[model samples]
Target: MPAKKAANQPRKSMKIKKGDTVKVIAGTDKGAQGKVISVLREQQRVIVEGVNRVKKHTKVVDAGGRSGKSGGIITTEAPIHVSNVMLVEGDGVTRVGFRRDEVTKRRSDGSTYTAHRSVRVSRSTGEEI
Candidate 1:
């Protein structure tokens, strides 16, 4: 059987998007800022450009017919929990908010319809992000 949906269930989404500048507020990398590379929605974690780096050691594999990649210790950015980072607005970081804007949209038959679109806004300055 399929699972039932909650009537009052809120929208599930991450405010910080790719290319957004964010600052680490907690953990060992606190105060470090970088662009958002990816968001792991299921894990509720985000991979920043230069934050939470980890080193991985791998074994080298050789292929006789084709070129193979050399294995060594490589450093890579790791995902950080969403709660540990804050979105950067200007010189400081601000909480994110959502607002609904009335928009005019067209349909497949060339009919126009009015709809409310949700947009992310900066809570501090009340400006769109």
Candidate 2:
């Protein structure tokens, strides 16, 4: 018999966004750092460039008689659990925090209004990420 894996925590807004550099903290690709290619919000997974590479054997597809697609073993990145990675700030990884700031917004009526927007911040340096 095999043991069951622990269930992931409830999904929340991910601090890491596409194009952000992150370092893998756990799993097979641990210690690897790369730019985030995509973020899977529902699944709580993130695909990082050059990390979690997997090979897929795809079959060729043909549509009608004019165009067709070539298929073969293709190497690509796979999604890694968000918890396994940390946001890279400056020369090291930093935990993400959120700060709400008041900002002036303009409406269609040409009136200005003050609004509070949430911004991601670096916990270590207390600076926006």
Candidate 3:
């Protein structure tokens, strides 16, 4: 049997995004800042470049190709909880907020359209991010 979806469930959104600069606010990597490489929405975790690094062990692969390949200990970024990082806007860290665009447009058919587009804004300065 499958689980039922709740009607009152709120949509999930992340303040951080790929290529966004962020500062770690907690955990061992605290005080570290880097670009967000990936976001794990289902896990509520994010992988920041140069943050939360972990070592991986692997075995050497078959060297049947043109170049020989060998696997060893590899260090890579691990997922960190999204709540532990803050978006970096300019010189400081700031919370993210969404704002809708106010401009209206007309279609080729001449019908008016006012679709609102959400934008990320800095919480401290209220500036567009």
Candidate-wise lDDT, in order: 0.92, 0.93, 0.90
lDDT of 2 by residue, 1-129 (tens): 998656785667888899999999999999999999999998889999999999999988765565667788999999999999999988999999999999999999999999999999999999987
Better of 1 and 3 by lDDT: 1
Model 1: ten consecutive residues of lowest lDDT: 61-70
Candidate 3: tens digits of C-alpha lDDT, residues 1-129: 999878787769987888999999999989999999989987789999999889999898978778789789999999999999999877889999999987788999999988878999988998898
- For residue 43, what is the lDDT in candidate 3? 77
lDDT of 1 by residue, 17-102 (tens): 88899999999999999999999976789999989999999888775566776788999999999999999988999999999999
Best by TM-score: 1
Q: After superposition, how far is residue 8 of candidate 2 from its true place, in Å?
A: 18
Candidate 1 Cα outliers beyond 4 Å, as residue runs: 1-11, 65-69
Q: Residue 3, candidate 2: how far off, in angstroms?
A: 19
Most accurate candidate by lDDT? 2
Pairs with steric clashes in candidate 2: none
State residue 94's C-alpha deviation in candidate 3, in Å.
Answer: 0.5
Comparing 2 with 3 on TM-score, the higher-scoring candidate is: 3
